[model samples]
Target chain A: MQKIVPNISVDCVIFGFDFKQLNVLLVERKLQDEKTGETLIDDWTLTGYHIFEDEDFDTAAARILKGLSGLDNIYLEQFYAFGKVSRVDSPKDNIWLKHQHEGFSSRIVTVGYYSLIDNSTVTLQLQERNVKWFSITDLPELGFDHQEILNKALEKLRSKLRSEPIGFELLPEKFTLSQLQKLYEAILGTTYDRRNFRKKVLQMKYIIPLNEKQKAVKHKPAQLFIFSRDVYERTKRERFDFSI
Target chain B: MQKIVPNISVDCVIFGFDFKQLNVLLVERKLQDEKTGETLIDDWTLTGYHIFEDEDFDTAAARILKGLSGLDNIYLEQFYAFGKVSRVDSPKDNIWLKHQHEGFSSRIVTVGYYSLIDNSTVTLQLQERNVKWFSITDLPELGFDHQEILNKALEKLRSKLRSEPIGFELLPEKFTLSQLQKLYEAILGTTYDRRNFRKKVLQMKYIIPLNEKQKAVKHKPAQLFIFSRDVYERTKRERFDFSI
Candidate 1:
């Protein structure tokens, strides 16, 4: 076991985009109440682990995520640090925590990170640890201040999707413009005029059209396009109005 | 004295705009080498303090800044957490650390925060602490990973200026289009085409043109403008190109 450093932790909010809605990973724990000796709610928490004395926080995050998802080389960005004094180990919250893990001590300040993942690339053998995926709309109350961390991560993700070409992280390697539009609408929870989105996207010099078409679609085959990072880096315009 | 929380600290990168260049507040410390029995570099550090056991990290940050600069209720936002296991207490850096702090036992994880300020609004009565503003360009080597923190904060600030109309944080209540353009150039370290910048800013609904003009100038008096937050909040659009 890694010797956990005192008063420090790392919590990760893993964002996975399915075909329709955005999803997040939460680890479920079954604990017995310390006072009542009764089983408490299987508290859901972000897939978090305590930082070791010798490990970088990001390294700890990657290890925890890899241990949970069996995936590596995921692009994780630090969003915010949730360091409110009342975050955890409160009189009311400590009992739930004491039942969850051993060697509970002083308050912990967590560094929150968010990773946007392509769901198709993740393995599905996550059965031993009671890990589950939930839609962004519906989530149970998480342990500690995890709900706030998840919310902040989602907020950062939404803002990033607007300004950065990171929306591609949530899409496949090759995607139709319609798929791209649907991804945005699903994450932003808003509808867009088809003509406006198409017109605006066509103006982006980085999104290149390929000579590929959908083979098994019922409707008319839409042309596939790939985001070219080279073009984006070379011909990148000032992103003064990404949200617009 | 506040009971300091061990192994965790908060360092603030206070950014001030003085019309011509961006400046950061750094506190200087005199340190002695433990083995050589000689003084080491009088290294500069950010306005920082250790987290108190019961206080919020941000609250500690504000209290430290308030204690250091006598400023209150100032807005400070967390940008990143610097958590390398070997950041401090190494043989190479511990000499400076030994002289500057007390009750130091282990490595620290510092949460970095950046705030933009109009220089005139801050109090100038900072006497006891060896605190001074250094232009971002000519800063000496900062101690304990602070240089990295400052760079990350600047990157965040530049990105923020593009996505949001935050440049006004560095300008007066009323400013000319030229002053606004200069502020952008100073912070971003880049220039924009004069006509293109004017056209783009004029397109913004929040930049209200005033009947007022610059007084007592050698050249023709140019019209001044004010950034209307009321309009920005209400007129926010998809920021697909805020960098323009």
Candidate 2:
């Protein structure tokens, strides 16, 4: 007898920064099913896989990240579970039909996780066919309900960035204030007044001004600031009421 | 070819109030393993079922609530997903392992939802065998990981009860201030100074006095209050911060 097991899986939307734009790691699908045999489809999708019977959700998420990005020791957070019956459509059927399943049909529940990583540390060793990074704002049409998943992840990222110092994950160990502000703008998808933003940052008392400045730039190099873990923890514990 | 499908399911922990204590609904298991012909142990568990392939998570949650509680149009929120591998120990090892190529190892992921309802409305219809309500503080040992699930749900309910007017769900449509305070005390699992608690309630400006008193009480009946939805919404939208 074949045991029918409810399949659990985890999908990670790893967001990285390239100093100019926020990008996400995606993989292209190689359609080999009979319905889409030899069909040249250029669909990019988030890196995900079925949870093995022995694996936990967090373990599955970590394994997927390690296999796809070749990075370890990264922080990942479980955000939401997607259980829409028709989230994954077969290639032969209409794209919209993917989100509709018949009575008691096959179902896949995906737990979404978001991770912030420095693209510079991402080794392309696990780069299989069609693996690439695209600017989050310029993402092409992706397979399944990945677009919705990405949108949710982006929303969580923005909310977290507003109250938390998660932007450090997207920056180098040492960075200038301009680069940090640019990263914030990319994630928030809006611009802030530079002077006002700087004033707010200084008031937060978490960003420490270093004596060093960036070496390269046509204009005068701006001083760099490093995030203080001590102050970050203190601010988080004290719960200062600041809103963006 | 036989199609193998994973069963999706939702379980709800319906919290109710009885003036002084918080209660949850539970049902005893009845299925017996065909091979052993032994009665499925007298293990009480939450009401749950496999999801129809086409149903959304919320839809499935509501369906379960209606089926078990005989109440519709109640408020339910999804809390956590229980996906442990050994959540269900196989009861049919002797029967299925003899002929089955793949053993009875199956993974079931259950999404937990918590609902608040007036205990008076829970018409105990279609109770299988040993269905009953247990006080949250006096719960018996439950089967599976239900104990952990209940703890998590209780935590969410307690945190939400402070900021939102969810206590109204536990109380009757019209309730005295003492009744409301009792619900909060039960949920918070602590005692509060009556005068201070009353002061805080007055400051909120949402709980309006109904100019009525309880008919049966040892002491002079306290004034009744009805939760104002408009004021609650406006307060929640503006400066809504609760930490307890």
Candidate 3:
């Protein structure tokens, strides 16, 4: 029997990019009535579970993600914790939790984590699970305050992308400037002037231009670039600007 | 009788700037033996408590801070959640919790919030309580996992100051460029070139030069400056740079 913390849970909003749009990994949860043993509701939820009795929150988030989707070693940053009394107010969600355990606690404090996935490798494992990736532009009605959680995750992702180079986590190792621009636009939900964006990005020393180009393309191939972590580490400044 | 969540706690690391140094607010906790009623241990701890049953994490944090230090309306940002099984591994902390309540559970998931206190106004209220501010450079032996929690809070504060203008929260409304520089140096624990710092700061349109000058100082009075939130908001960009 798995010993779990009754009052605490961890949810992960896993984001991925596919050269065009950013998507989130979500699991389909089917709820059933305890007495009838019949399906009561079916909806999507950010992959999550109550923490093990002896596990820390980070460990619990990683364990839950691995258990649900078979994704290992994927770093998850805890961005927020949702503890509103009304988090599980929906009748169906309340009933579902009560049915899941003998004496389930409805008042759960969920630690929210946002993770970025390198889609090229994790796609195969995700395809084998009972999970699906939904674009941030179009999302289904999520269960148990998950819509709010996912929205907060996207907001955090946008803010993080503005200050950090985490956007590279979602793109291919070797990508074109247009692909990079589209990934930012999709996540940020705005279009940038192509030339200006390219100029700004090219000025960044860490983005190294590879002596390579896209193959088998109808249009003229664009130069490929790679994000060098070593250069970023060396050149990063401990800067505090008046950019509130 | 106060109803509280047995498994969830909220800790606030309240930081303040005293012109020359960064300080943190902490409470002195004296634990006694349950059976003997004799003091068993005495140590300092971050101001915190198990949240009330009907409250959210933010509400709980604010309530705890208000109840303990008479501080109100101070915004506390949730920086991290600590949920290690051994967070209360110290025998004294375990004994203290047991003494505080009957049948108390030791496995607590603490949501950590870092609050910046504008020392000028809140200092008087804090003087009446058991709480005291300690310099970040010289801290006492903290109880439970509080030292770790406080360290993490400082790390968060440093990183936040590096990107966001939260340093203003720790400064006086009217401050000189030297004071601002000192505030950054005190928190970041690094000195900056005076000319470069002033040049970079003057270029920022938000930090406006006031027609005011320092009074009653040991050295020559410096020109005062004020952080203009309106200007910052109006001129802020949604630009994502490859800094790291």
Candidate 4:
């Protein structure tokens, strides 16, 4: 007299910053409709998966990351869940529905998680067809509500960048203040006063000045700064209020 | 060549306030393992599903709500996505890995959404097994990281309750001040000085004094008060400091 449980799944939108633009990892869907047999889609989308009955959602996400990108132990955060009925559109009715015989019609609930990683370090396994990085500003038409999911993740990322040290995960270990400024500008999607940006960062007392300079640049070589370990550790437990 | 896309899903933690306790809806998973052939394990969890290939996550959530709970067009908020390597624990070796050949091995991402519903209006559809409510304070052991998901949802709910008229969703259309106060107490989970609580609520000007009284109460009949539509609408947009 037990009830049949619906399948659970996870999807991730991984964002990376490369000093110039923000990018997301995307993969093309391989499966075609049983009826239409159309394999081509408009644009690629983020990586995703189905949840096993015994596995935790977080674990499923990590497995997706490692399996697709060969990266493990990176920071991944859950952002949103989508559970609309008729979310899936197949050419045939009751075809996929037959897969799950439990009275419940065919439906899907996808949880969205995002992560910041050094895109350069990501060694793509490319198990399927194509795994590529798409510029956030120039993304093609995505499948499902992924565009909305990306937008939400970007909003969260921009908000978190101001308060948390999440930017470091997207950037290289060492970076210049101008590079940092550009990162903020790209995320905020607005040009910031360079002096004001530098002043605010300096006042925070968390950007440790490194005795290093950019090797090659057209303009003046700016001094490099690594995030202050002490301040990051202290603020790890402290809530950030970046209400400027 | 086209790419293979993993399926997407969404799960909801519908929270309800019963004036004295915080409650969430839970359903028992009915499917038995194809391999183990064992009956139900002690894994009770949230209601969830996969995102259809054609639909968005939000739409999917609304569909599940109607099909499972018989509620339509309720307020639902997307909270987080759960993506981890080991989130799903099945008898098979990482459900995705076991099905690695079918392109289904790729990780599944699930988006978590929550809604605040008036429990009184909810007519539980008995299509599934047990659709029961459990007090947040006294929830039995759950499957996967659902407990953590509920915790995070509660955190968001508590923060939202402080600044918005979320309590109205849990209360009857026409209610008494004491009843509204009880809702606050349930959400806050702390004792408040009745006089102070009343003072703060009155000062907010969101509750309208009705020319009616509670019927058949053991003690003094409390005056009925309707939530002021105008004030609630306006204050919802203006953020209120709720640090207390």
Return the top candidate by lDDT.
3
Query: Model 2, DockQ value?
Result: 0.17
State which docking tier applies to candidate 4: incorrect
Per-candidate TM-score against the hidden true structure: 0.89, 0.70, 0.87, 0.57
Write out the backbone clash pairs for model 2: A1-B100, A86-A98, A86-A99, A86-A100, A89-A98, B8-B51
Report the error of model 1 at residue A144, Å: 2.5
Candidate 2, residue A218: Cα displacement in angstroms equals 9.0
lDDT per residue, candidate 3, B144-163, as tens digits?
99999998999888877876
Q: Which digits, one per residue and each the tens of the lDDT, describe model 2 over residues A141-236? A: 887789999998997677566655788888878888888889988888777789987777777677889999988689999898888877777655
lDDT per residue, candidate 4, A1-244, as tens digits? 3222255557888888777888998886445556889653435678876666556677778888888878898889876565555455443324434543555435556677898887778778977478888889898767656777788788666645544566767777788888888877777787778898777777656678888998878988888888765776665432211111
lDDT of 4 by residue, B36-128 (tens): 876545456887765555566677778777777899978788776665545555544243235435454344555678888878898899884
DockQ of 1: 0.52
Question: Residues B136-172, candidate 2, lDDT per residue (tens digit)?
Answer: 9888867767788899899767755644567888888
Instruction: Identify the runs in model 1 with alpha carbons over 4 angstroms from their true place.
Output: A32-39, A89-92, A125-127, A202-205, A241-244, B32-39, B89-92, B125-129, B194-196, B202-205, B208-225, B241-244
Write down the DockQ of candidate 4. 0.14
DockQ of each: 0.52, 0.17, 0.55, 0.14
Across residues B1-244, which tens digit of lDDT does each residue of candidate 1 receive?
Answer: 6678877888888988787888998887666556896876677888777888888877888877777667786767788899998877555367666655687656888888787777777775566657788999899878777888889999888877777788887777888999888888888888889999898889888899998999999999989999988888887876443111
Q: Which stretches of candidate 2 lie over 4 Å from their true place?
A: A1-8, A17-23, A28-43, A90-106, A124-140, A154-244, B1-7, B29-40, B90-105, B158-168, B175-185, B188-220, B223-244
Candidate 4 residue A231 C-alpha distance from true site, Å: 4.3
Regions of candidate 3 where Cα sits further than 4 Å from its true position: A29-43, A98-102, A123-130, A192-213, A220-226, B30-42, B99-103, B124-130, B193-213, B218-228
Would you give me the overall lDDT of model 1? 0.80
Worst 10 residues of 4 chain A by lDDT: A235-244
Pick the TM-score winner: 1
